[model samples]
Target: MIVSRSPVGEIATALAANGLILRGGFNFCDDEAAPAAGSAAPAKSVLLVGQAGAAPWPHFQRWLERQSARIVNPLDTWSCEVIGAVAQEFGARAVSPSDRPYLPFQQWAMRAEGVKPSPLGILMHPQYGLWHAYRGALLFEEEVSLPEAHAANHLCDTCVERPCLKSCPVDAYSGQGFAHEACLDHVRGPRGAPCRSGGCLDRSACPYGAEYRYPADVQAFHMAAFAAL
Candidate 1:
């Protein structure tokens, strides 16, 4: 069955209904080492879908309330289902950051948004800072029109304090790299109540996108999931 191609605005509007934004997109070159979209041929383009700050939280909460059984990785499941449905509507293939044989989502984000890593390792956007997240992406057989991704002002370069590095209890993020084990231990221990109930102190220390920061309930949910790891 031939599916009619939806306009970019139509796709973006549909995703926005669920609090998802079109992060950006790029047309794949024939020689590019792009990941296949569950098809024999590589996708002609990709449109990233994500949320800025707590936009997806309410939608996620409502969906969670409707679940009859306990869900493992509820957010990821919701992302897959929502994006998958949209992809089907547009005759595109849906892919997630958590898919097995992981796609280069981080790389794609950089290419699509020109965002860079902060001292805390989260991709710091000029406006959204660490408060944004990529949920999934749609792979299209036809090249979709996209806006140019100009490099945004790097907020970290001018921030003299770099509070994110200093705020961590265990100094989980350092010049070397993230001390994952140290972070995990602290988040799971008795003294980890603050982070467990709120969010990562280091992430909270970021001054760039304070206004877009996730709500306490949303942060708490993510922290609980992190602590379970």
Candidate 2:
């Protein structure tokens, strides 16, 4: 049932029909070592989907299981669980680096490799606006070649309002970049009531893909992770 193909475009089309937005896709070769070397098999392909409001994670897992796709951690691997396991294995303490919330290791991997964060990690897309997240990654056993990574097409280039930077009450984000401590203090301290209860001010301020926002609980869990760091 899992259709294997070199052209990811086909997979994107199929996932779209099933109500999942293909936020990003990439491939890694076995011959070459991973960006961070490890014993685990090198990832052949990675697909990020935005299932917001459309399906619960369990439903998505069921679909993948039916497709015979090999998920990295699957829905059973919660964010906390994955982080804990990876940290224990790698001997690196998990730390929250983003001003908004705690992002997954893969998301952080992109950043570590100098992939600038854009809305939903798709540099060119005008929608999503960093409101979405990496639900989980899927790895295939077979080789799947994908396009080379390209420079991000940031929507910030055309936005006249630049609402994301200006909308933050704590000024957590700016052109220079995110202020992590400032954001954490505001989120955990007395000043954080509005943000803690209502969600991230900066992320919510983005006009693109308003409907793709992460669920309230997901958002809170991420916020807590950042606060822990």
Candidate 3:
């Protein structure tokens, strides 16, 4: 449990054996001014993983649930669940966009201590594009030192065509910012058929990570989650 060195490679191998791909790991400090306080003293570790399809998630969840290790948030739960539970343990409450609509959760998440959104989320990775969703986080009981945060690498910076910005028929993304209401309306209304069937047009159109694209069902599920919010 006291991993003084990089346990990422070992963890990745284990995940691969279980049919899950290790995405990355992050460290969180307890004393940092997190939205929710009272987390364990020192720092904790979170390991991220992705499955090829939806079936693997359920299997992964079952495997995680059976592990003796203390998981702050189990595989089946969302990030909100981990944040809320940790907040409660520390006698604080987690604040998210869903919980506080006016606050910018994306910006807040980026700035928060011990929180690191994967750079892949912003860039089109060789595998998963924007079609991927952060399923959940795994928390450890022990504190671990981490490296300094880095600026997110956005593929949009290098793309000449900027296909992702223009791919959407609804023009949901303006490059300056997203048109949230327009995106939601389009997904929930008649215009949603293509996106609902294939995937987010903009995300799919990204020339990066064509091979790692999320399955259609996974894409639709994530899109539905966004629409529900």
Candidate 4:
């Protein structure tokens, strides 16, 4: 398609139409190059693609099922396939978080979105909170014009109650840090039912983005993935 808008704008709109959103993005100046091979120069900019709510779950699930017949790692494969195709169309390169030594997506998200780490350790978006994710990105060899990142309120700052800090029965997340072993043990044990079946109590307790919370089965998928790991 002949996109009259800037490349970033075009890419963002294209992704939204495909069940994804251009959640956040950043540009790499010549001095601070992106980490990628072959070009000795990284893409001029990186654009993140992901869903912010359950609205895209059904579409993603259908896409996943269609690929189950041929791809071994469906989610990763699907991300790569969609992003790769879009990159090719836009004269860019596709990359994903699954890549080894991953692309520091969390770090990039913070910088590009002007967000900060919450008590939960993940970046707390004022709108999506803990319910969103960074799926993949596109890197262009040439600079792609993009809107400047703006300062945003760190949601946790104004959250006086901080329900996420106290909701976990096992105290899995706190200012001290996450108790990974304790969390895993609890989730796999008999008393883990609430967390295992409904998702983490702590995550659900967050006041932000309740409207964007993942559906039960979607949360169940993540819980199962964590359990499997």
Best by TM-score: 1
Write down the lDDT that model 3 would get: 0.52
Cα lDDT over the full model 4 = 0.78
Superposed Cα deviation of residue 81, candidate 3 (Å): 11
Give me the runs in candidate 4 sitting further than 4 Å from their true place: 1-5, 37-40, 68-73
Residue-level lDDT of model 4, residues 14-108, one tens digit each, is 77666788876777867884776226666677777877876567766888776636655666676777777787888777788999876788878
Better of 2 and 4 by lDDT: 4
Please provide, for model 2 over 1-229, each residue's C-alpha lDDT reduced to its tens digit, 9 standing for 90 to 100. 2234454565455444444444555555457443332225444444444444433444444554675555443443433343333334423232322213543545533532223455323332334555544443334443455555555556666678767677677788765677878888889898787677667777767777667676676566456655752
Off by over 4 Å in 1: 1-6
Clashing pairs in 2: 119-130
lDDT value, residue 210 of candidate 3: 69
Listed in order, each prediction's TM-score against the native is 0.95, 0.55, 0.58, 0.90
Winning candidate number (lDDT): 1
Candidate 3 segments whose C-alpha is farther than 4 A from its true place: 1-10, 26-31, 34-44, 51-123, 143-154
In the range 1-229, model 3's lDDT, one tens digit per residue, is 5457654555445545445554454555456532322354433554444454453555545666677876543344443554444434433333433443344334433432223332224423334445343333334445433454454555555668877777887787774577878878888888788887766887777776566676776676567666762
Which pairs clash in model 3?
Answer: 38-90, 43-143, 127-212
Better-scoring candidate (lDDT), 1 or 2: 1
